[model samples]
Target: MPVYKAPVEDTMFVLYDVLKMESYGNLPGFSDAPRDLVEAVVSEGAKFCEEVIQPLNVVGDEIGCKRNEDGSVTTPPGFKDAYKQYCEGGWLSLAFDPAYGGQGLPVTVNAIVGEFLSSANLAWGMYPGLTQGAMAALHVHANDEIKSLYLPKMATGQWTGTMNLTEPHCGTDLGMLRTKAVPNGDGSYRISGQKIFISAGEHDMSDNIIHLVLARIEGAPQGTKGISLFVVPKFIPGADGEAGKRNPVSCGKIEEKMGIHGNATCVMNYDEATGWLVGQENKGLNAMFVMMNEARMSVGIQGLSQSEVAYQNAVAYAKDRIQGRSLSGPKSPEKQADPIIVHPDVRRTLMSIRAINEAGRALVLWTALQADVSHRSEDAAERQKAEDHMGLMTPIVKGVLTDLGFDNAVKAQQMYGGHGYISEWGMSQFVRDARITMIYEGANGIQALDLVGRKLGAHGGRAVMAFFNEVGTFCAQSKDDAALAPFVGSLSKGLKDLQAATMWFMQNALAKPDNAGAGSTPYMHLFGLVAMGFMWGRMAKAAQDKLAEGADERMTAKLATARFFFEQLMPESSVYLARVTAGADSMMALPAEAF
Candidate 1:
């Protein structure tokens, strides 16, 4: 079995030292989340996940989930007991409103807890992970009665939740959906349709499953404009607010997927299930986006989680597995062969992944703090600025992290050679599980397009411009500091490349939109490199300050990783910039019939 020790100390370093988290003390949740409290929460969370959740990862993969004759699904053994303990621990309500029986903590704190759980067991984590999105949607759009009836239970994990959107005919194009909802006499709608690939769609873990579904109301506007959102529960709530008779909804089947088999990706059937409308009529997409956006960010964390675990295992293997004599010399003369960690090529691979994992963790935590500011900050201007940064970083977080995460998984697996191919070593499971993150929660290709097509220009490019200014200011401020010169210089060059790519898109994409389409993925990656470089710059500055204050060996290690990122990883932005400038000519030149 694979071993997982949660990166709690690293998380604290990013939260407290690098980001200066205490600065947000005035915020609602931050005031309560003092350093000691935050550390205690993460430490406890790490213990729970490492002890309770991780043991089920390989078991979940092997046994998976099963569908019974009654259309109900059964998860792997110990899942239900684990979930019960999880809910009893109040793990589900850490970041929610205290009025809803939550701890009233910041999303950043919840995000940290989520990282530990995901790293330990991603498939098992999806059950509660999807519920958070569902709760966010209902909290934002659902009416008071819906909130009163569902939000509290959902928050406490007594009733789990799901987002039901995709059908067999549609995934990305919501305008093509065929699901239908007809108004019943007493202010309720009858939702009747099938939703496919619904993660955590059907399970016996909770008392009730509250499904936030999307369907078109009768005679509404055509296409996406006609769509409406609905809250359809597996068991309808009675007047006393408990689950009553079973509703008409049922799971038709579960998807036999390449990974995350533990999560029952169900094909659901709704036969005129009693449902309540959420948000406004003909504005379903707007409401559904709340869940999608949250899911997208959560999915990005999944990528980071897998990368962390893979890197841990790879580092362990590289140290213990003796391969050949070190190129420098036989340092371990008593042994027949030196460990692979001594090899230059092996070090390169390990350092590359280490750089991405650390920087990626910083990026995710930084973005999570931005999310907290967007939601909890008192100043309207501050909230708007944080929201802008959040929008700009979301796609990059989802795309770059998952893409590089999968790559790292493969690289880590390579470190194990043939053992990685077998099941007992458990490396292959990490590769398999990591692959789905790139495909789901809005595929990475779609994420790239969103970065170039939507987010770059949202709010008249205020967000992207804000991002540029932040990077520019950091680079400028650090230019004179000799200890920080390496990171600052690399970041300066990366910012220029990002700006040039943005200008190229502005200059060439309007007249020939294919130019934008063809370059979108590369531009997304370029933007991601700049983002990661900015994070590394911040980390390096913190490391420098800590070293000046006589911190410890960890500070030195942090400096080394930050240097590796600047020297080895950040330069790739220029290559992507080159590709972005190349435009659509070569890609578009081929005739449709040529191949």
Candidate 2:
């Protein structure tokens, strides 16, 4: 079994030391998250996930979920018990609104807990994870009656949730979905359709499953414009808002997937299920986007989660496994050979994984804080800026982190040689699970397109310009700090590269369009490198401050790792720039008949 120790200390470093969580005390709900309290909550959450949930990871993969003759699904043993404990622990309400039976904490604090759970056991963690997204969507778009009907139970984890959008015919193109909803003449509609690849779609863990679905109404205009969002529960709520009669929703079949075997990714069949519209007529895509964006962020965490676990196991293996003599003289002369850690190549691999994981953690946490500011800030201007930043960074976080995360998992598996390829070591599972993050939640290709296509010019280029200004200001401030010169210098150059790439697209893409499409992926990755570089600079400055204050070995280690990131990892941005600048000619050269 792969061991997973909760990274509580690393999380605290980002939360308090790097981001300064204390300064946000003035915001509503943040006042309750004092350092000691946040630490205690994170510690307790970590203990629960590590002890109660993590052991089920292998079991879930092996046993998977079973479908019965009655069409109900059964999860792996202990999943239900673990979910019960999670609900009783009040975790579902941790970051929700108090008006709906929640504890009303900051989303940033909740995100830390979320990362830990995901790292410990991603498949099991997904049950509550999907519910969190559903709650977020309903909280924003659902009417009062709908909120009253669903939010309370969902907030307490008594009911779980799922998003139903994809059909056999459609994945990314929502305009092609065939799910239908016809008005029943009583302020409700009858939803009828089949949806495939619905994660957490069918399970016996909760009393009811609230599905936020997308379907077209009768005689509406074609495409996504005619689509509408609906809330259709597995069991219809009675006048008292408890699960009553059965709704017409049923699981057609559970997908036999490459990973996340514990989650019931189902093919769902809805037969005239009772449903209510969420946002507005002919605007379901808008309401559904709220849930999609939230899920994308969660998917990005899934990327980081896999990398962290893979890195931990790889570190352990490198220390224990005996290998050839060190290139430098062998320090462990008592043994026949030195440990793999002594090898420069092994060190390079470990450092590469570590550099990305640490910096990725910082980037996600910073964005989570931005989400908090977007939702909690008193100043309208501050909220708008934070919202714009969140919109701009979302695709990069989802795209880059998952792509790197899968690569990191493969590298970790490489460290184990033959054992990594085998099943018992658990490294293969991490890679398989991380694979879906890049595909779902808007495939990384689409994410790249979104970055180049929509986010750059959003609000008259305010978001990207804001990013440039922040990096420039930081580089300027650290010019005099000799200890921080490497990180600042690398990040400054990265910013310039990113700017040049953006300008290239502006100069060439509008007329050709194909030029933009060809370069989107590279440009997305370039943006991600710069974002991670900026984060590393912030972490380096924090580490430097700690060292100046006569801190311990950990601070020294942090500074060294930051230096490794600047020296080894940040240079990849240049390659991405070169690709982006190459444009579409070579990519589109071949004729369709050539294949």
Candidate 3:
């Protein structure tokens, strides 16, 4: 069985030491989340994930979700019970509004919880994850009446939620969607549509499911402009706000997916479901993007979560599995042969995964802090800058983390040799689960395009420019510190590469849009490298500061890992930059019939 132990200490270090989260105590939720409280929450969360959630991972994968003849679905065994425990523990309400029955903690704290949940049981995680995303959308865009009726129930996990966007004919192209909503001559609309790939769409865990669906109102304009969002619950609430009547929405079937079998990815059929508008008419995409963005961030963490678990298992295997003697000599002379970890190639792979996982966690937390700032800060300028950071980093987090996360999983599996391919070892599940993160919540390619095509130029490039300035400032400040010289120097070079790539896109992509399309993926990764390198620099500085006060092995290991990141991973920025500037000629040269 695969084992997952949440890196609670590392998370604490990043939260308090590197990010200095307590310094923002003036913020709404931050005031409630002191260091001790946050530590207790994370530590308890870690224990819950390790002891309760993780044991069911293989069981969930093995049994998957089952759909019954009544159009209702049953999740994997132990999932429903585990989900109940999760709700009673108040995990879902950690970062939500206190007015809505939430604990009112910092979003950064919730983000840490999210990583733990995902790492422990990703399939089980989606059930609540989708609900949180839906609640966020409703909180932001839904009318007061809707929020009052739904947010509290969803907050406490009495009612879960799902986002319904993709139809049978459409995935990314919302304009092509044909779902229609006809006015019922009252406050409600009659919705009729079929949405596929709906995660946590139908299950027995919650009393009701709140589906945030995208549909076009009758007589509305065509294309995406006509799109509008609707709150279609499985059971419509009565005057007293209780689930009184069964709505016409039902699960058609659950998808036979590549992985995450424990999650009920359903084909939902809506037969004139009674629904209410979420925001304004013809502004569905605007409203749904809120949830999409939230989901994208969570999906990015999913990537890291899988990679972290996979790395842990691989490390355990490396230490125990005896293969051959170390090239330097017999390190374990008493044994038949040395452990696989003694080999240089094995060390290289483990270090590579460790380096990225550490930096990736930091990046996730840092970006999540920006989210807290964007939502909670009182200053208008601070909010705008933080919002810009969220917009700019969202795609990078979603794209780069998943892309590398899957690669890391594969590398971790490679450590197990042929056993990794077998189901009993559990490494295969990690690779399979990690694979979906790259494809869902907008594919990595779309994420890259969003970065290069939209986010990069939004608000006249304010976000990217701000990122450049912040990283450049860090590099400049740390240049003179001999201890941080290597980290700062590597980060500086990576930042320049990102800047040059941005310049290339500005200069070349407009003349030939294909150039932008061709270069966008590399640009996203290039941006990710610099962002992670920046994180490493900060972490190195923190480690050095801790060491100055007193020496510690943990801090020392942190420095070593940061060095590995700088030496090995940061240089990839140049390779991606090369790809970014290579242009689209050869890539697009092949004619339609060439294949």
RMSD of each: 0.8, 0.8, 0.8
What global local distance difference test value does model 3 have? 0.94
- TM-score (C-alpha) between model 2 and the true structure: 0.99
lDDT of each: 0.92, 0.93, 0.94
Candidate 1 residue spans exceeding 4 A from truth? none
lDDT per residue for candidate 2 within 262-330, as digits (tens), equals 999999999999999998989988888888998999889999999999999999999999989998799
Q: Which residues of candidate 2, in runs, are more than 4 Å off? A: none
What lDDT tens digits, residue by residue, belong to model 1 across residues 90-182?
999999988778889999989998989988999999999999999999888988888989999999899999999899999998899998999
Runs of candidate 3 with Cα error greater than 4 angstroms are none
Weakest ten-residue segment in model 2 by summed lDDT = 565-574
- Candidate 3 lDDT over 1-595, as tens digits, reads 8899999999999988899988889998887788888999999999999999999999989999999999999888899999999999999999998888898898888899999999999999999999999999999999889999999999999999999999988899899999999999998999998999999999999999999999999999999999999999999999999998999999999999989999999999999999999999999999999999999999999999999999999999999999989999999999999999999899999999998898899999999998999999999998999999999999999999999899999999999999999999999999999999999989999999999999999999999999999999999998999999988989999998999999999999998999999999989989998998998899999999999999689999999999888998889998999999999999999999997
The TM-score between candidate 3 and the true structure equals 0.99
